[model samples]
Target: MNDKNDLERLRIQIRGAVQGVGFRPFVYRLATNLGMVGWIKNSAEGVWIEIEGTRSQLDLFLLKLEQEKPVHSLIQQLQASSLVPLDESDFEIYPSVSGEKTTIVLPDLATCSDCIRELFDPNNPRYRYPFINCTHCGPRFSIINALPYDRPNTSMNAFQMCDRCRTEYENPLDRRFHAQPIACPECGPRLEWWDHHGKRLASDEAALQAAIQAIQNGQIIAVKGLGGFHFMVDARNSDAISTLRQRKHRPDKPCAVMYPSLAAVQKDCELSDLEAQLLTASEAPIVLLRRKANISVLERVAPNNAYLGVLLPYTPLHHLLLSALNFPIVATSGNLSNEPICIDEREAIQRLSGIADAFLVHNRPIVRAVDDSIVRVIADREMILRRSRGYAPLPIALSKPVPTCLAVGGHLKNTIALTIDSNLFVSQHIGDLENQATLKAFKQAIDTFEQLYEVHPDLIACDDHPDYLSTQYAQHRSSKFPSSQIFPVQHHHAHIAACMAENGLEETVLGVAWDGTGYGLDGTIWGGEFFLANLTDFQRVGHFKPFRLPGGEKAIREPRRAAIAVLYELWGEAAFDRTDLTPVQAFNAQERDILQAMLQKELNTPWTSSAGRLFDAISALLNLVQISTFEGQAAMALEFALEHISTDEFYPSVIHQGIFDWSTMVEEIIADIEQKTSGAMVSAKFHNTMVEVILQFARQWKQKRVVLSGGCFQNRYFSDRTIARLQAEGFQPYWHRHIPPNDGGIAVGQAIIAASQLLKRGG
Candidate 1:
């Protein structure tokens, strides 16, 4: 040691995601390994580090700290200053700062490999335990009540840790080191069983086994998960599936299946390399895999679809239950139709009383309700259909940080986003906030996100629809915070912005946004639209031709009515003269007369340029679906009917001045019907024509990037073929990756657009 003056004590202030994601333990390990004397503790501001060591050793420690941090941790700032040396003997980690107000919060993590191994290992103490988890895995965001990420700040505070768990939590070498939710079978939450009538069954392992037996016997069981409850039934039982459909009022929307393992999934569907990887990834999202030929799943599970939405068990509870069952289970959300998922046990019993035959209840309370995420493989890349569960609260990295803001999403598939500093926390899927229950859930989620992330928005952003609940909520909040700016973004523009943000594109591009309906700037229903847009600015350059919706909102529920409207637009009065139409035959004489008169008088009819309407028309034309039980049932059935068609020849409607010649398409479709073309062939031809039209537009704007978004892109046939054709033509085509292409992603897009607008205004 040359000089004693060289020895110094330095205090470092570290910030930016330096909490909750094993950052403290990482620091402890690093400091101990560096042979430096330091005491590190987490404060509300950030990690506080005081080190007294030789200058060279401190330099090496700093270098290693930057290079060797935890995989998920982000160190944004590291401030170091010299202090008087105390000559501490060893490095130690102090308890987290008490009662501190911290801005940083951690996301909930999927179960880690180490925990998974323990769950499966026969020799491990936690073998096959339904509640086994450690620091790197299990619940964080959902159980959390306040910041600093300690057990007392979570729902887990009610359960005192046993001595063994406390010892393991204190040991840095143990996987449970500092795990707030650490628990064992003896000390953690236990499962209980209940009948449909809210009467408690036997509270033992036999109860769980009996619950599994009931599911195998084709009974619907409501099982509580980490975030919410799920209704489970045997996948092979058609009667049970139909019963669930009728009870949930979800007749045609595909229900996801939970398989026991990946090996089981391989038997039912053809999984690609990426599909398999995504299935095995920590975020075990439901992967829409191509189904095997003649696989005998209940027809009601994926009515009229070639692919099945499948997911492997993500949680220990699911694993244990599925293993006991030894078969695929139809695991759909436990809720009434169009309602938010039930999280509280009392609420679940009250709401799902008539839907499920039994209940697999748990003692642990779920502070948040998160639905299972759904995804599909398009062009060899994973595309999110729904973003929830393992994905939410994990902030999507922005190209550039923005000021604090809150984004209230669209009327349907609603979710809210809050941006604080550099992190943006999105709420879980909030369903349609059109009803009282969903609206209440939306408000609760918003409050929870703000409290957890410690953010108060300086600006509020919402969809342009004045009547939407989300918009009204934003308006109310803005009125309360009079100084905060409020901005309304066009719905389709938000769709394109979401796509652009996901792909990290900055330049202007061609955006094709298609969906069911959105309140257009011109006050007409806009769905099929083409826009020239970037982050802030968007111009509508193209759209589908407008036609009268015979009964307005009634037409959406009845596809045959939309078909009659299309027929009237195409063949005029001669449409009723056709004797071969089954839809016409299905209508009684009085009903037919009323329909014709309504079309002629245009009573309560609204004009729409919606691609979703075209799908309804095709569905009714094929006689495949006359009345849609769900929102997009007719379109989904139409897509299913197209599975038999070849992609050899494409006949697309001409585009003039950026508008699709839908009148000509309708005439061509009528001609095909007159020629006695099979419904299957016509459906295939219609799908191919749409793909051709999209490709044509991409070729026209070859210089600009092509972004595919909106709920319509959820149709795999159109999205897959369109992407392939565009890539073949040597044009760059981008689709959604992390966020959903549907309205679920609209909140993030709204936030980005709002931030850009604020920057433009120099706010």
Candidate 2:
């Protein structure tokens, strides 16, 4: 009815999270239903579409495009331009074009609801298919090796699709249309069970049955998942869990448990609405929830912890396995302590042979390793404890644009980040860089990020710690990329910058960066610090009083040594004669004399203002934990020891010349111990004292915006109370949500600070 002159053409370019999310097929269906002639194709930049129709039709298409986008698709930027109409009869999906990559790679999603329904339906052709996936779900970053996100670029390229799957993929009306990982049991990758000795046991359905039986038999099974392998064992089998702990060399650190259903989770642990929502969300992460009373089966699983990390099964295979068992299972990372998770089958078998009794693996190769993410609710908001699996390679939007850079994170809880335009891409949790294997994994993660995004950084950022392996790697990389400048960021400053960057704050703010240890610019170990910081720079304002760490790094693993050091600082050499103190009683007279000599001679003793060591000292003084088996054990024990007491009471402390001295509080605690005061009351008073110190500092500062960062903020009780107090005092306090407060998030901070410095230099 309309004249040909009324026809118009529009060429649209869509960027950000558009590919691998059915954007092309969605566009094709929209165009066909509207009776328009056009073509859509995938490009390195994103999706490109050209359509010709009446002006009204084109206008309607554009409106619907924004209104009815796919659930997983995030359209960050869209540009449309007028183009000459080509009189085509039907719409088409062209092959993807290759160029300099600029598109964002979507994180691997949990199985979708539609897929879950199809998985359990008896009549569905893809019933019980572990690889069953549609455009809405399944693997993304884990299986992707190259850009454009086409089938040829994924691990599924090895297995050719059958006729039915091909038909569904080519049909614009089907949900599986353009689904890169779509396949059926007839042609998809199959599961295989193998013994620890590399002998084949079973295949397909029998393989799943074999795994289930092994778990029932109290044997450890290394199961391959979407991101990496996991060591699954019956949670109720205390002996089996103990064996796993001994074998995995993880003695005291808690393991995550995967429950059969939400009902089962609620039965074992208390769950709030927000926690429940996170468990069932697409990015299913292990959430730390307070355990219900008398859950005896989980006693050995979490040990002395007050909370348990629980998650619902996210994959079809997990659902199938859990459905058969109808119970909870310990699903910890499939790697040894302080190492990256195993991704390849051979690698998993090699690394986990001693720990796993059997293997539940498949042919689908995992291109990169991604551990399950861990989170907890703090200040009524979800705070990430570990960022991996469901949440890696996703860019955190920056407030302003800067030059490309790579940030090699701190020594412990290592993670890396790279900047492209205004987006900062933080890598998954790459374990501690202690041994060669972990260091290799760290480098590989950086390489993977660079290859996937095609980013050659113009700047490199690293912690100021000269002895840290991450800093050394940054120096080595600088040698290779001679044109790139290397920037060594101060540790606490980087922590504050990372929190500020994620919150999109560009203005100056008062930053409270407290952790166990960091390399201070003053050539000392600094952790408890206050700073006036922005994204570009920071100035150290106040800090905790310095104390000598006897036996240097040995004091970290042995809290009694820290306690002895504190006593020595307060009472000098005569402090060792206090035989009634728990720390003195824990060590013999000979050992006490040796420690006193070490302190007096300054032999391997380093001056530190570390807040973490202070917590260790307090825990040791309370006789809660003398020798830590894992990182943050003493601090965690301190937090868990709090009883229902008065929140308003706090020990007396004073600040002199910007030094928030803990001497007065320690003296009060000693007096309380002499008076036979309860440990809970003393612990509560100590926590309240720290809060009071923070409040006093906030009152003195003119800045209203307070940014909390570093590992100390991981304590939910501390953070929640701090945020509440700050809010009550008419101050705005911001903490991490998507990123962790530990060293795992320092890379993000490093990247932002490096970028800001480079921009200031007009790079």
Question: Highest TM-score: which candidate?
Answer: 2
Per-model TM-score versus the true fold:
0.93, 0.98
Which digits, one per residue and each the tens of the lDDT, describe model 2 over residues 165-227? 999998878999989999899899999999997678899999999999999999999999999
After superposition, the stretches of candidate 1 with alpha carbons farther than 4 Å from their true spots are: 1-19, 43-87, 98-107, 120-123, 582-586, 699-703
Clashing pairs in 1: none
- List the global CA lDDT of all models: 0.82, 0.90
Which candidate leads in lDDT?
2
Q: Give the deviation of candidate 2 from the true structure as CA RMSD.
A: 1.4
Q: For each predicted model, how many residue pairs clash, with residues at least 3 apart or on different chains? A: 0, 0
- Across 1-763, the per-residue lDDT of candidate 1 in tens digits comes to 3255777889998876676667777777877787778798887667899987888888888888889887656776688998998877788889878543534556556678788788879898777677788877788777889877788889999998888888998887676888888888778887789888778886647667878889878899999888889999999998999999988888788899988888888988998899999998767888998888767566678977788999888778887788788889999888888888888888888999899988988888888888888888877788888888767766665667777789989888898987666556677788987699999988988898777656677698899999999999988887888887888999999999988887888689999998878778998888898888998999898898877787788888898888887878877778787657755665777887887888788787788888888888888878888888777888888887777577555555799888887777766776787899877788877888888778777777665589989988888888888888888888788899888888999998898889888877887
Candidate 2 wrongly placed segments (more than 4 Å): 643-646
Total backbone clashes of model 1?
Answer: 0
Model 1 TM-score, all chains together? 0.93
